[model samples]
Target: MMLTIALPTGRVFSDAVEMIAGAGLPCDGLASPGRKLVIEAGEFRYILAKPSDVPLYVSYGTADLAFAGGDVLLESAMPVVELLDTGAGRCSVVVAGPRSQAERFRGHASELMGLKVATKYPRIADGHFSARGVQVDIIHLHGSIELAPKLGLSDCILDIVQTGSTLRANSLEVLEHVCDVSLRLVASRKSTALRWKEVQSVMNKISSHVKEKRP
Candidate 1:
């Protein structure tokens, strides 16, 4: 029986492919898939998808397993079995805004009330602000969230920050940290149940490499 794995096709793609290869799995051509979305190597069939779509593919049983970032998983809220922290694509989800808003963000609860926030992660932004008892008007955007505040579209932005370079370039600064994000190995619930033996075998092999990488 062949094992199908979904790998995200962006910043974390190389890391995911490397992890699988290091685990003694065939991952040839994954790093350079070119225009192909599906790749086959030995007993493994790989599905290339957007990071945000990884969970959906796995949960729908289209792929038996996948590697995705914690941020994407949280935003999508798809039900998939999180198997391992692959320790790839490390970053943070944060609340950020213009430097001028920093003091206002820190001092005035009144200012925070019904604040205008822009983000690609609506669910995550809502959850974070709601948990803090702050009401916000969430403006969902596809990209360039950092421009929201400057463009007078939003008071702040909740987004993934890798090195703070983008934020700095946009004259934005992080006001609060939402969560640390990293690539995680996830499996389809049905696949885990029906193909436990094969799934467990792959898990064990990957786990060894994961353990070896840390400390």
Candidate 2:
């Protein structure tokens, strides 16, 4: 029986397809043009989902497995087995703002009171700030969080920093690194029991391929 997997529809999709194929699994029909939500590869089937929604698909057993960023999993609070860290799409979650603001944040818990922070990941942002014993107003934006600080819309921004180019271009500097993020293979708990053998085989193949490709 072929397993169903959820593939994220974005820049990482091609690399994900390559990884799946490297693991000796069928990985065709991923390149079909325009809004084709589902496709088949030999006996295997796949559903293309938004990066953020992949966890939801797997959690509800709509898709047996998925590949997505560790950040997404962390923010979604979904219950699933993290089968493997694919190590691609590497980035870091960070707290960043103007250099002058960095000095104020240093050991100054009272200064953070009533400050506005902008981010796409509100949950992650809230947790980070709350842990620091600071009260924050979260401005949730879907894209271009770097603009928040520059526009004076937010005093700081918590976001994924890939190369820090965007931050530097906007005169923002990384204040602190929150967590390292990469693509992860995640599966429903039911998948572990129902498809253990197949899952293990796929993981083993991918693991070997990853080891072989390492420099």
Candidate 3:
């Protein structure tokens, strides 16, 4: 029997391939894509999927396993089993804006009021502000969240910070770090029960490879 795995496509795909290769499941076709989404390596079959859709594919059993970001897993709320944290694509979700406004917020005794905040993550933004007793108007944007504060669309922005260069380039200062984000491996519940031995073997291989590569 062949196991079908979904790998996220994009920047993280390279690391996923490295990990998969290190696990002894070298996907040559994926290593050098040629308009192919599906490929075969030994007894395992692989599917390339959008990062956000990987979890959904696995949850519905379209794919037995998937690689996705921890943030996507939390936001999607899919009922997939989180098997491992690959520890790559490290980043932080943060609240940031102009240094002047940030300084004022630090001195303010009252909860932030009547402020419009922009973010790609509405759930995270709502929860973060609510916890601080702040009432905010959330402006959801697909990209360029930093432009919100710069263009006066928002007083603050909630977004992922990888290198802090983008924030600095936009004159935004990080106010607080929300959470650390990383890539994670997830598997379907049915897959786990139906192919326990096979799944364990593959997982063990990948886990051991990860341990060996770590500094």
| 73 Cα displacement, candidate 2 (Å) | 0.6
Pairs that clash in candidate 1:
none
What ranges in model 2 sit over 4 Å off?
A: 31-34
Q: Could you tell me which 10 consecutive residues in candidate 1 have the lowest summed lDDT?
A: 102-111
Stretches of candidate 1 exceeding 4 Å from the true structure: 108-110
Looking at model 3, report the run of 10 residues with the lowest lDDT sum: 103-112
Which candidate number would show the highest TM-score if scored against the true structure?
1
lDDT of 1 by residue, 70-172 (tens): 9999999999999888777899999999888888778856778988999999999999988888889999999999999999999999999999999999999
TM-score of 2: 0.94
* Model 3 bad stretches (over 4 Å): 107-110
Global local distance difference test of model 1? 0.91
Error of 3 at 165 (Å): 0.7
Sort every candidate by lDDT, greatest first. Answer: 1, 2, 3
